[model samples]
Target: MRTVIRRTAVAVTAASLALLVTACGSDKPDAKKEAPAGDKGAQSSAPAAKALSTAELEKLLVEQADVPDYTVKADAKAKPVAAAGSAKADKAACQPFADAIGGTIATPAGQAVRMAVLTPKDSGKKQSPEEKALAGLNALKSPATRVLLGSYEGDGASEALNTVKNSGAECMSGFTVTQDGETTKITAATPMTLAAGEEATSWSFTMDMGGGDEAKFNLGLMRQGNTLASFYTFSLGGSVEELPIKVIDAQEKKLA
Candidate 1:
């Protein structure tokens, strides 16, 4: 009877060992399996963050500035939608301005600035060429800011400066301009100016990016009734980029 009991105990021990080995082998595959349904919700809701694109930033800035409806041209006889006052600043404006300035060139990683403008709505029957130009500034729906990569020196310097200054740019000295590179930068919270009376009460400035890339750009902000406009221009390495300025509110600037 004692011998019979010992044999039975040995047989039981062998069976237990085999079961344990099988359990361990099965666990390896299960460990590699995907997570259960319980975890799916958490992963789907949290996506990686992304930086804002240039177009996005421009749009954001326009919203902040509160731009109004504007027309481009000096002919007062032209109506806002008819002659000189026609041509709303829209997404279509981006490609044309970009094309005019050779938008294919590379801009530095952080070389963006904001500017705005405000002017009374053209209530007159006729719009002038300058009025149409100003209107062109307002039609842009994006952050029409451009990075000045380079510009030709010599004869074009004064011409470029005058062209910019005439557009309500406030001159900033102490900034450098270099050959074959970027030189200066400007930033703003609103439009620059319009007809002296609309000049911005806020402050704007220029900074050097170091090396041969010396350049200058004017940031502007202003209010035309409830409307606002932002614009800028820069000279770099013999090239100039005139960024489109946009009116955010779409309301026409009216005279008081």
Candidate 2:
């Protein structure tokens, strides 16, 4: 009877160990199954907020002292208009082109658009060599450097950038901008290299000045949070290299 009782106790101990081992083995598969669910949860997490107010955008503009010899001021009465013959002529094709050049983006309803313009200090006064070169290249709308700052709410900045990236090729082809009774034909907008910003897109386009001579212009679009900045620089003959990069860095630092 004593031997039988001891054998029964040993058998019970063996059974308990086997059950523990089976449970441990089962837990490994359960953990492996739960890991992917945890990963999926992490993958579906919401993105960070990237909205900027108008005042914040206004503060992000490059200061006059930062870009010495340049006049940086807010355009109180500036209203962005589409390039002539755009929406009126081909609404579908022209819309994207208009947004790209005008720095216009699709924003949530009730959001206002803010803008500022930058140019050389003596843009309205005497014509400096640099000013003359820029004017000859059609880089200045009013004898200024013509950097535009636009701030949008919601996903407007991303939308504007997508328009350029997705439909730029189709919209830019045969695009024309008519100003002051003169029409300049843009043959192509080729992508250029960018050196700064969180995300940036640049292009060098050939403009038919309606003469035998053609002018080249550089357009840069940079996104910092919800703000989009545009830089336009062209020279009669000299290269306007790295100017956009400087402006982008300055603006990005301020935004940061």
* Candidate number with greatest TM-score: 2
lDDT tens string, model 1, 1-256? 1121111111122222222221111111101112233111111122323333434333333332243322211222211111111211123312212111222111211112232222223333255777655433332221223211112123222232233333323233221222123222322212232221122221123334445443333333222221122333332222222223233212123111
Model 2 Cα lDDT, one tens digit per residue, 1-256: 1121111111122222122211111111001111222111111123535565655555656776555323344444554333322322133554554445533445522222222123323334456777555543332331123455566555566566656655566655656644334444666666666643446666666666545656565666666655666665544333333334545566667756
Count clashing pairs, candidate 2.
Answer: 1
Q: What is the lDDT of residue 12 in candidate 1?
A: 22
Model 2 earns a TM-score of 0.57
Model 1 misplaced stretches (Cα beyond 4 Å) = 1-49, 55-66, 69-117, 120-173, 179-256
Report the number of clashing residue pairs per model: 66, 1
Best by lDDT: 2
The CA lDDT at 123 in model 1 is 30
lDDT of each: 0.25, 0.45
Q: Provide the TM-score for each candidate, comma-separated.
A: 0.21, 0.57
